[model samples]
Target: MTTPREHVRNAAGFALVWVAAKAAHRVRFRTMGSVPRTGPVILVANHLTMTDPLAVARVAIGHRRFPHFLAMQEVFGWPGVGALARATGQIPVARGSASAADALESASERLDQGQLVALYPEGRLTTEPDQMPGPARTGAARLALRHPEAPVIPVGTWGPKQGNGHIWHRHTACLSVGAPVDLSPWAGRSDEAAAREVTDAIMAAIRAEIAQAKQMWHAR
Candidate 1:
């Protein structure tokens, strides 16, 4: 059941996100319907800049699903945003922990409760000059493999940042929602190899969407 505090938090968060999206000027949201309306969902997306989370949230909101991001533990301890994040139920991931067990357990609980959980498989912003997505962290795949009921959806987000500057000149960005990866084939295995395989498949889907977004950006 939804608590009064949660309801208030969600409403406030959505309002704030709308304001931020509008202030950012131009953004293109695509394939939002790929996320199902009701049920547990695990969204895996590529992270390029700090603005990626907001862009991803837009996609999820468009699909009528509220996204609970797997953010760093320190972020949840931040001054003002921390309180809001706690209220909104964002999962806190500890730094330097390879397994991210605390976060995974929280995420699993949320999934069992039929809520949408979002993660950046790359774990951090891209350092590459080309800004392509970095390696996939096993956490996302592990979560999916542990709970096979919730389908893993790959989301590609690009162009949240234009050049090295913070200001966006109404730049054209893309949020491509790819098809959900089928993980039924690896249901029983929770080993490193199975997790790696699932992570690769998810990454491939995300990369395809990224390529498509880049192509579309160029075409425009």
Candidate 2:
């Protein structure tokens, strides 16, 4: 169930991202319907820029779901943004500290509550010149195992990184969300080896979608 404040915050966040996206680029979302409308879901995506959460959140809202992301603790300490993040129930990741574990635990609880939990398995935005997602962190895999009932949907985002904050220059942000990664193959196993397999499969799905998005972008 959602509260009035949650609805208000989500609307505000969507509006903020929409306005920003309009100034920065023309945004397009594809295959967003693939995500389950109601239930526990783990949204795994490639991180391209700081604006990724906004873009992903926008897509989630469009598909009738609210995203609870694992964001940096420092971001939750930001002025107005921090308050909004808290209001919307975003988890804060305190890198290099026990808070990170707390964040993961919190995320698991959110999943148990049947909410959508968005995570960038790469852990951080990529610095690669090509802007591809870096290696996947083990947290995502472990999380998936802990809640095997929740499907991990791989979403690929391209173009949001191009505009930065240059309002005068318009770019295009293309997001493509694919079907959930199949985990049935490792159903009974929650061991490290199984987690590693699941992790590779999750990353592979993300990479496939990212590659497809890039091709689509370049073809345009």
Instruction: Give a tens-digit lDDT track for model 2, residues 35-149.
Output: 9988999999988877767778877877888788999888988897788788778999998886688888999999999999999988887777888876777888899999989
Q: TM-scores for all candidates? A: 0.89, 0.87
State residue 114's C-alpha deviation in candidate 1, in Å. 0.5
RMSD of each: 2.3, 2.5
- Candidate 1, 1-220: lDDT as tens digits: 9899878888988877766666654567668467999999999988877566777877888888888999988888778668867866789899697756889899999999999999999888777777788787899999999888898999887766633366554455677888889888898999999999998999998888888777666665
**Model 1 global lDDT (CA atoms, 0 to 1):** 0.82
